[model samples]
Target chain A: MDREALFQQIKKKNSYLCIGLDTDLEKIPQHLRSTADPIFEFNKQIIDATHEYCVAYKPNIAFYEALGPKGWESLQKTMDYIPKGLFTIADAKRGDIGNTSALYARTFFEYFNFDSVTVAPYMGEDSVKPFLYKDKWVILLAHTSNPGSSDFQLIESVVTGRKLYEEVLLKSQRWATPDQLMYVVGATQAEKMESIRAQAPEHFFLVPGIGAQGGDLKMVSQYGMNAQCGLLVNSARAIIYASNGQDFAQRARQEAVNVRDEMARHLQDYYK
Target chain B: MDREALFQQIKKKNSYLCIGLDTDLEKIPQHLRSTADPIFEFNKQIIDATHEYCVAYKPNIAFYEALGPKGWESLQKTMDYIPKGLFTIADAKRGDIGNTSALYARTFFEYFNFDSVTVAPYMGEDSVKPFLYKDKWVILLAHTSNPGSSDFQLIESVVTGRKLYEEVLLKSQRWATPDQLMYVVGATQAEKMESIRAQAPEHFFLVPGIGAQGGDLKMVSQYGMNAQCGLLVNSARAIIYASNGQDFAQRARQEAVNVRDEMARHLQDYYK
Candidate 1:
């Protein structure tokens, strides 16, 4: 899925929301628990209910990995269950050497069939380069919203006189085109949105910390958005475990609809 | 395990070697191909033969993850095959937000049962803090040997007038003690080894880029060594795929012994 296709989907649905499949075993509904693959069963219902209303699904790999071997089985099943048109992300923050990283690209892009994967850039270009395959996005970590982001990433570099995150943005962009590269700029860092935009004006951003992290969607849309509606705002806990009851899928859909409606308003403003 | 325990083991075996279980399915012996799980079987045999000669086994997670669900199954089996006392690493360079990172910690330390996992410190303290559990090690990416590592990591920081990698080292030490944190200083970057040691005088380093990447084990030991002989020099391709014949296990043992002998010479110099 390319950026233009993603934008069209956002326009068609009038939503820029990406459902986070941070699926935990113990938190899943009881009805699905009896099934051989509870995580997949739950994901199927949620995807079926909410696919039309959203453009993407970001599955946090750690959740599936925590269940040991069984969690991985569920993750594979869940990946298969996601519709073809909707963008899929194996939210596995993987980064390593060039040769090893090439294998990671094969893992998510070829084996599990994901459109993208999150990566840490601390290992520099070689670690992130292998994943920048044709049409597949590599969402590099930049100016995150977490509190300790200020510790090292926000520090100013004496050489370039730019923040560390800015240097990552500048250096990594040379490795891949905007079509293959995206950045993860947190929604809670709304104040720094304009500066982030100034750094990499063309790339899309996979923005988390929207709902459960209490980042205001209005503030995010106001400052962080681009001409292409270059944002895939993710909400994990807010949509997945909205209700732990048997009506979990139904509540998830309702929560998703609320986000989509707000996003529609943001899209309308984009035209203005 | 703590520094004392690891040092004691290294002394007992007379080896500073850490065999990298970068087990690729296509690279394993053809005889193991017919086994129920070729990857796991290959790892088991290699571990069985080389366990006595090496201090630790580092399984790069990308290889297993590429096989999809079955690959993960092989990873768990391989982890189980490693003896209780032998240190195991997930080689998963995972780093995220505080809440998400907490779950990643549980995935490796609790579920997969690895003693340590690699992490990228580009996102700063919050990204790394979650992985520092009671008795686990969080190996942060420091001076990587990749060509583009100087892109951002080597930048001089305005605040400290220190290189970005040095900043990562100085700031990250505040989050965890030397026991809980380690650095990934590439073996190829031997020229900078003494400077890295001066900045991070006490922390252990997980050194890669040896053998296959042409990093000199001799130079790395000379400058990168600390009071505890604090270096885990990894050789993946040169050791594991020493041969593809039925005598693969014997060849692997010999290759491991070679690296161990070189490391022993380094440690001997430190003792003198």
Candidate 2:
């Protein structure tokens, strides 16, 4: 989906939350375990419960893949369960040689029909460019929240004097237009949000780590929001696995609603 | 596997070649099409015929992922078919947030039982550190051969004032010792092998783009070799689908033998 349509949805729902469906079989409610496919069953109910409160759903590929063949089936079913208007992300951090990456793009975009996929910039342009079609979004990894993030991503280059992640944000901008490219800047690193916004003010940032990861929502919105209200704050475990009892889906919706309500406050300040 | 064990296999077989099992269903031999599972049947034959000549088998995950559930079943069977002593790789370009990335590490290392997996370091150290464990390796993407690599990977960073890829190599070294980490430096970009070797020096490099991508094997060997002869040069289509007829496995063996002979010369130089 295009940016304008995505923007319209955010405005319509009064939220910028993207609920992450990092569903795992062992973690879901025991009541759903007896189903033929517990992962997909859990996901179907969660999507149904939380659809209205969030603008998007991100299904991390690893959780599904760990289940082997059955996991992939669950991923495909979950993608179909998500409604058309809401954005869907195949959170498969894929990047490879050009030809191989093209096939990956085909798998997520054509066969599975995801609106976007997260990409790793370490492979350079050819690996990421193949994923960018007419309206498909390529969310490049910029500054991450993990402690080890300081190891490589924060390194200062000897030639240009910019940190490595900053160069990734600056250089990757040349490959695709702002409409087609987005950056992944973790919500935990709220301090860097202002510098990131200044560098790529026109692009959207897919910010993960709000609820469970302890990233402050207000701080992220204050520094990262642009003229377009360009941010998608994702909260995975804090929502989907909110409860392990029969009321799991109901509890998930409550958690999603809580995040959405907080996001509404951010949107009000965002517009002002 | 440890570098000493890998080197022992290279010495015993007199080959440094790693055959890439990028098995695509449409590309399998026609006779195999009648088998219960064409993709798995094709992989089994290739592994049976070429197991003695090659020390490793690299399966590109996207090929298996595209077929959905059935394809994944084929991938597991293919992994099972390879001889126990031979090195195995899941060419899954995975990198994500720290906690989520830890799950991916478990998926491949525990569930899939791959000796190593490819990683994209754009998400920084946290995305990569979770993959390093006892006896398992995380091969990070370094310098790829694609046309768009110059856009971000080769750009000059203003902070460190060096090219972006160099910073990744230099900074990521601190996270893991050489044995636990490897880097993927494309064979097509052989000219830069000198610099890569200088920076990485001790780590093994998973070199793609050798056969089908038209990279010169001789030039790559010259500049990319390390003290331990640390390079896993892969050839995918040029070996696995060497012939589309019924004699595909036999042809695949012949192609692998040819690369093995060439690799012998490179290893010989290392011993010298």
Candidate 3:
């Protein structure tokens, strides 16, 4: 989907929430384990329960990959099951050399048909450029939510005096427009969101670290929202694992509703 | 595999030549494309022909991933076909948050049973730590082979006056010992190999960009060799695509032999 279509979805739903499908076989309800494809089954119910409340679904590829070839099947099934109009982000942080990266672009965009794929900026321009297809998106990693984000992303550059992530934010913009490019700025770092938003005002930011990761929805919305509701605040564990019982999907819907309702209020108050 | 075991294999073969199985269905001989599981068939023949000459086989994961679930099957079969006592590197330059990185670690080290997986150091220590299993390895990206490697990698840090790649080399050393850690010092950057070797004295460097990318094996061997002959120089296209006809396997073996002979001479001249 293009930038306007995504913004329309957020506006129509009155929500900018993106539910993350970081589904683990071991973490799903015990009864579902008896099913043939437990991961897909779990994701199907969760999507059915929460699809109305959210605008996008971001599947963390590692969860499916750990299961081997069978995992890829589950992932493909999950992708097929997600309803079309809503956005899809393969939260697969993939980047490599030029030719190898093109294969990855084909993997996520052509084979699996994701709207976007998260890419690491460490490999620089050519590694990231292949994924910048017309309507498809490349959500480059800027300020990550993980503790380790500080390790390298914060290092000051002697020439530009910009921190590593800032350099990533600046240099990457030259390669693609906001229409096909976004940034993965973790909600955990809400304090930096204002400046980051100021720097790249037009681009969307896929914000993770809400709910289970201790990121405040109010704070993130206050500092991060844009004219088009330029934020995809993701909550994975808090929504999907709301309850491990038979009412798991129902409980997930309740959690998503709560987050979405809050997002609606933030949309009213913050979104220009 | 541990450092001593890898060194033993290198000494036994008198070579540290790593064959990259970047097998593409479109690029393989037309005859092989007609067969069932052609990727695996081609890889099987290549392994059969060249296993004795090379000490390590590095499979670029994107080639398999682009083909979807079937591609994964071909990779598994190819892994099963490679002979015992040779090191395997999953050139799947992957890294993410701690929990996610753990899943990727399981995918490669446990599920795929690779000796090591190339990791991008963009995510910091925790993202890399989970892959440091006993007898397993993490070949971290220090300076890459591509032209874009100059973009962020060579950015000088204000505090330490060290480059970004230099910071990666220094800071990452604190996370793991030389036993399980290695660096990817690209062959295209042979001029920097001597300084890199000095900074990372004991750790092995997985050198790519040898043949098709125009890196000099002799220069790389001269500057990058260590006490344990710390280098696994990789040549993919130059060796694997030596012929496109039915003689592909035979010709591939000849190319492997030529590279291995050159590596043996380097070992004889440079071994401490």
Tens-digit lDDT track for model 1 on A64-148?
8777668778888888888888998888888776878899889888888899999888778887888978889899988788788
TM-score of each: 0.96, 0.93, 0.98
Q: Per-residue lDDT for B100-215 in model 1, tens only?
A: 78888998898888889888886778878889887789988888888878677777877678887888888888889999989999865566898899888998899886773233
- Clash-forming residue pairs, model 3: none
lDDT of 3 at B236: 91
Candidate 3 lDDT, B171-237, residue by residue in tens: 9999999999999988765668889998999999999876632338888988999989899999898
Candidate 1 has a TM-score of 0.96
Sort every candidate by TM-score, greatest first: 3, 1, 2
In model 2, state the lDDT of residue B258.
Answer: 81
Predicted model with the maximum lDDT: 3
> What are the per-residue Cα lDDT tens digits for candidate 3 across A227-248?
8788999889999999999999
lDDT for each of the candidates?
0.84, 0.84, 0.90
lDDT for A8 in candidate 1 is 88
DockQ, prediction 1: 0.74
Instruction: Considering the two chains of model 3, state its CAPRI-style docking category.
Output: high
Per-candidate count of clashing residue pairs (backbone under 3 Å) = 1, 17, 0
Give the number of the best model, judged by DockQ.
3
| Docking class of predicted structure 2 | medium
